[model samples]
Target: MVSFIPSKQLTNPQTVLPEQLVEALAHETPLAFQNVEPFRRKSALADGSQKFLLRNQEGKPVAVAHWASPYAPHSVREAIARVNSAKQAVGASLAPHILGPVGHGNVQGSSFGVFQYQYPLSENKFFWPVQRAQITPHLLQFLQEVARVTQVPVPTSEIETKFAAPLQHLSLMEEVPGEIRTAAAQALCRLERGLWAPRYVLMHGDFWKGNVLLTQKQPPEPKFVLIDWAGSKVQGYAIFDLIRMAASFKVKPKRLGENVAAHCQILGCDIRDAKSYLLAAGGHFALNLGCFPLERFVCMMQASVKDLDKALAATEVN
Candidate 1:
């Protein structure tokens, strides 16, 4: 049996892995180690998903694993399968190859999912600043590939349903302006009505600089790779990923608008459609903002809301 530690205490990578995880890994993969040290805590999602990196006995970084609590075992299995499917669809150049799940079971009485680690393209911080010119083409190219491989069967009804939490929470916040609340509500309605319909595709779900890495820094042909596939989805709006990517680098509203326009041009879609999707995505973040307690989430929502309003205004005139 793997020894247990308080989840709260599992903060630093210096902490040793639970014997259970170590044994599980050794049993599943050829890789063996005498010691395991934490590398970093990647993310702990609102839904109780946790990611961690660990170094093996040889001091070589070996595995990165995601553990999801309070989830059905089948769901964890499904996520692994989905990650594998996504990796195959995009190829190793875009999505990193997962080493597959080593072991999974109850940890601290909550169900967990563990996966193999894949190296990121760039080890720099997620919010590391880079010139727009450097990343735009690569971002566009990724979107194009996603579009090419995925298909939209029918409009998703969850667009409006997903905003329910935001709307409900905002309604109780007297500090939030009535105008903001009304705008969010209206945006939700528009999505429900199929105004500014978006093409559904296989989405990275949490595309951002933090989840994206640079494999090759050579200009004009730089290679980029995406990580953190736990949130990957089959029928997701591309705009959600695009908006999150812009927010990750803290791009301002004007620049964000310009980028959205450029993206629309490349995809041959209406800018209004992108904006509508942005609005919905903003509300989704707003709902979850209280969960993570990160300032970056606030910044992202602010930019998303600002660009969303601008998009709505432009649509009204046209």
Candidate 2:
């Protein structure tokens, strides 16, 4: 069992940088710095790890260090090792950019890579900490990987069942007191046909906005590169990632469709695919809204219904 330290202890050293972090950064980056600072955090810290800013040997700002909390859950501790593993996998399989451990310990058992600084945003917010983006190609591989490890039903049926609850939740919201809405009108089109995520994927199940990084382009148009995989699981659905990816763009000031496109590309499933494999993703995300008011949840579903109707109409006309 991983030794436990209370989370309060992890956040106690508010100012002085961690020696472990300094050493870890030295191994990851080329910059040289002599000092460090505190990195602002959010209730945003997932998995109980604390974040900090640090300087390198050359006196330059280097990285955001994450140290594990005391009394950290075993899952959180295991996440740290798993995140390193995911980084190594992505690094070996995809190259050009590099990975740096920004937060340490159990913030969802992962690290946010440096490449995430380029996410699309109209303004800076206090709690934004994503470290990467999911491009089309990367997304497809992720889909297959998630299918590989889940070890459940086939992609199509599994995705449908997983998404059933969320779809119904949204469906219920779409239906008027006595009216049959388009989503409810159809027999859950995706449900009948089912989606295509692999039966199991070596996946990052808890992958949320905070865990992603989008890769940037040559001119750097606020693009991104994804990082962090401490909560990555192997048995998730491709749809869940898309839902989270799409949601990440929710706060963005522009180009909602285009952003969803990026996520679509990653999954290799166009938005129009009725039998898409992302039902699991949709349901997974609905679960994320548990903290919100029930009324707000209905509003979100209504919007989803409108979007789904438009997408279907377009597909049918095309």
Model 2 off-target regions past 4 Å? Answer: 1-33, 41-47, 57-59, 71-77, 80-223, 230-234, 239-279, 286-305, 311-318
What is the per-residue lDDT of model 2 for residues 1-318, given as tens digits with 9 covering 90 to 100?
A: 111112212345554444444554455444444444555533223555555555555544444555555555453346556656555544454422224443333223334222113233222354333322324334434534433333354455454455555556444543232222344323356455644333333455443454544343333333333445554654544444434444544423133344344444445454654223343344454566544555654554444544444434544421
Could you give candidate 1's per-residue lDDT for residues 123-241 as a string of tens digits?
Answer: 45542344444665577567666756564543356544554445445444444556556655665566456564555567776776556555434545545656566567676555667
User: Per-candidate TM vs. native?
Assistant: 0.64, 0.51
Clashes of 1: 6
lDDT accuracy of residue 46 in candidate 2:
54
Off by over 4 Å in 1: 1-18, 42-52, 68-78, 85-136, 151-179, 185-195, 214-222, 250-259, 262-269, 283-299, 307-318
Estimate the TM-score for candidate 1: 0.64
Report the error of model 2 at residue 206, Å.
8.6
Give the best candidate by TM-score.
Answer: 1
